[model samples]
Target: MASPSSLLSQEQIQCICLDIFTSPISTPCGHNFCMACIGGYWDSSDVCQCPLCKETFYRRPDLCINRTLKEISEQFKTRLSLFEEQYAQPGQVPCDICTGSKLRAVKSCLVCLASYCQTHLEPHQRVGTMKTHKLIEPVSNLEDRLCKKHQRVLELFCREDQTFVCVLCNETDHRTHNTVPAERECTEMKVSFL
Candidate 1:
């Protein structure tokens, strides 16, 4: 059962600033942006246009912040903080991106080789390229998780060798070895144990 905070989609709550919503204002074209972000954008532009969709407006949109969005953003923020504090207890891996006081890592990216908290994991969830990064349960010592010989994530389980292996390892030393994705091997092992 996933926790309430685990269900939060950062992609929806965030604005153009790449941060959580602050004074969320809606454009006439129905796109939402932070008040300061939109204000500065309009100030630098020659015409009033939607930053997204590129729809030009005859006149500037109202500066009023959307009360509903503001309330939702605030609620989301509160829940996020509560969740972060709860997970910050000892024995959990801390987020690599967080400074000062680090929060517990929610996911670890095999590609980035770094762990992330809920807040710091936004880019992987939102950005197209980063979305492809393989994320697994938070684990400490990410450097040790890599295959030393190949310098790649140990994402494969070499069934013949009974060891974790990497893609490059399969191409070279493990060419004849029976291997599968580490996740599949884990599931198979769990079922056998059960």
Candidate 2:
């Protein structure tokens, strides 16, 4: 008999919980993510890439809900809720580092790309190199911030292609395209709307 934790690992829970596990879908590459998560991700980009393996699919494949996984996930969720009420606070991201009792995350490190609770985040505050790491409010779907092709953080927006690009991407595929820091693009668009 598999333990509850073994039945659903932290990574699996993250993927399922981030998108509420509604209508779970499996890709041809054998990766599973919430249907809404993959749909929204593909809708924003030009290509269909698996969030976990970064496998690109030229055409969008037919999606079907995995009834068995869904049922198991639902059962697990019910059991977890019954085990601990108010496990995660309202509007708070759960600390990925916590094992038994997941705690609310206080900060997220961009360098490590992981959320940490107040206790686990101490190293970032105390260590010199870690102190330089950018910390922001906890965010789900950290993988979306990465470039699929280069596997680097998307920091720039390509005006010509109208998509996010990483630093390395700017030097390669988008070298000719007008590009600017993502922040600058946001600022420009906001100013234009005013």
lDDT of 1 by residue, 19-57 (tens): 889999998778899999999999999999988889998
How high is the CA lDDT of each candidate model? 0.88, 0.80
For TM-score, the strongest prediction is 1
For candidate 1, report its TM-score: 0.56
- Model 2, poorest ten-residue lDDT window? 1-10
Deviation in Å, model 2, residue 131 alpha carbon: 1.6
RMSD of 1: 17.4
All candidates: CA RMSD (Å): 17.4, 20.5
**Can you tell me which runs of candidate 2 are displaced by over 4 Å?**
1-87, 188-194
Distance (Å) between predicted and true CA of 143, model 2? 0.8
Residue lDDT tens for model 2, 66-156: 8977887787777666544434576668888989878778788778989898789999989999999978778866788889998888889
Best by lDDT: 1
**Could you tell me every candidate's TM-score relative to the true structure?**
0.56, 0.50
lDDT of residue 69 for candidate 1: 92
